[model samples]
Target: MSGKQDCKTRYPLLLAHGLGVTEHGGLYVPWGRVPDVLRAHGAEVCFGGQDAWGSIETGAAQLAEAVRKIRHLYGCERVNIIAHSKGGLEARHLISAMGYGKYVASLTMLSTPNRGSRVAELLLHARPGVAVWARGNDAWWRQGGDKHPDALRAGEQLTPAYLEIFNRTHPDACCVYYQSWGARLGKHNTDAAMRLTHGLFYPAHGDSDGLVTPQSARWGRYRGTLTGVSHQQLVDAQGVDSGGFDVRGFYVRLVQELVQMGF
Candidate 1:
């Protein structure tokens, strides 16, 4: 039964990546082997295909299109979304603000800054050169295939103040089921790649996955945090298990639960 097709859902699953990433390129997958594993378990997996640095609104627009395309291609009425980090915000915007609520069966978010990120606020409010830095990011991403990337605006939208307004404006749709998961680094040295971010995020927020805190990551159902995992590790960016946390298996179980839920 372990090798059986057990993770299939009523609606297809769409994997939405976080900020500063493409879904997959070459042998690299921001979601690691999760997509393939889900497919192997009888799940029809798809990608949100949003821009790496686009604002939530723009990302939502892209997701809206992706949902429509997926619905048409798969001949399904709705999809179950598994969004990471900022992608969660985009998914929320699509379902609530973009009038795609009826098209989404459920939303499962990972390490999303639902309330907002103090780290983002700290970075954005750093200096007068923030605008220049944002422009530089946009330029780089544009060169990398993002048509109208707005790094500054996108970063602003991640701040607590902006998210406060955002949460008020984009309330959860009654038609959609929403759930979220967070991650944590355990200690400052849990993941060397996340060391700096963990250092920066830990003082202000108690438990975090380098970038997003547990509090900020909680929204809707609030499934709790994945202990001993970094923001990157949560998405399997490094593609290896860490401290007993099997990122791939975690996603498999997640989808399996979705299956049980009749999504």
Candidate 2:
């Protein structure tokens, strides 16, 4: 908490994981490797906490609290946010809705669904029972019902409501950066099944990181894309492509970019 305080020095890195999942889930995936690698490279990594099934607003509030705590503990006003999946949406909420942009230096999302997913709609309809169960257990459920007018209005369209708020609030703050990556299953394995399930629920455009597609992941300005990395592989330290590419290194690079940005 008391390391680098200079504005030019590396800033503490806050990692936000996507919805219906925990930080450990990210850690369990290939993308999770980013935190360890970033820490090895002198990044102060913190995970955003909120119920895995929580709404974007709820997750953003949690992230806002985490940011305040990070700033209080580190004595740094600005921190870099490296979010994956729903975590990206939560980070955007923190900056745009919770007013954490004042404390945010940069934001990088990994396989986030900035655009609405047809798969999500299908799941909402196809698996009403699952949706009810998820909603019941989800933190967002505590706030309001799934059919709540606000909830209905927020993510009604392709961009979703929370994402629109994020775009309006953050609107490319100084030194703010955005980038994304995607993955697909090559064979019918456990990982591939997971990707298929995610696809069924998220229904992204073209290629995806299993759940969210590269196109769905776009928000703010575009940076570029990384192909052949599955959603789970993106954070898994043990995950390796047949081509021998280090999937975790991709996230590490993203973290490094945030650190270089003074966040």
Candidate 3:
């Protein structure tokens, strides 16, 4: 119950990042200082280490491997996954379709598009050169150490139509605790980089965190929304903040709650 041991969960915490992101480069990869903060609070933290841009199936395979490594390294049976964006989908796949439910203690998703995103639908059909662009991105990421980056299929899988079938095929694992949190940008200018995405995604989906809408982010226990937080700020990316939200403190409390739940 002390501050030093506030986030000491029974199992190690695995932080999973979303599409077009990796936790292997720079000073701050995906979760920028989040893992450090968790560790400071007596929690063991690791990364999913999935491809920067890959299909959910491939990402889930990588996550399963990551889980295996983490379990062996820590000599623990299960891990508490805290995934963001597309990483949440991959975690779900790993838990259900991949039959790794017993290895996962809980899943807490941040801004995941569990019900699919309208932005993906628009990107898939709105532009004629979308496929071409995806192919280019795949090639680039492959050179960056991705063995099977499938940008086209990755984007396709995020569409509502595809996920409707995906949901049927991949139901939630009964053994794992699942919860999700949505983020809401107070305005388009909440994060300058998110302005364009906010402009495009807001028209049809209503309240959103620049990319995923609140409706699409709803899944599992639905842990409410983070007001004035952009998608980037959700992970403390680029050291940006919205409405003075304490990004690190938010995660500290999140992990503390998980510990309190005896995860």
**lDDT per residue (tens digit) for residues 108-152 in model 3:** 999999889888888888456987898888888899888798988
Leading candidate by lDDT: 3
- Model 3 stretches astray by more than 4 angstroms: 1-3, 25-28
Candidate 1: Cα lDDT at 170: 92
Across 1-263, the per-residue lDDT of candidate 1 in tens digits comes to: 34558888999999888888887542135898777788888888899888888999889999998999999999999999999999999999998888899999999999899889888898887757989888888888898888679988888899999999999999999989999888888853357757777786668756678888888999999888788888888888887887889988998899889988889
In model 3, residue pairs whose N, Cα or C atoms come closer than 3 Å (at least 3 residues apart or on different chains), thus clashing, are none
| lDDT by candidate, in order shown | 0.86, 0.60, 0.87
Ranking by lDDT: 3, 1, 2
* TM-score against native, each model: 0.95, 0.75, 0.95
How good is model 3 by TM-score? 0.95
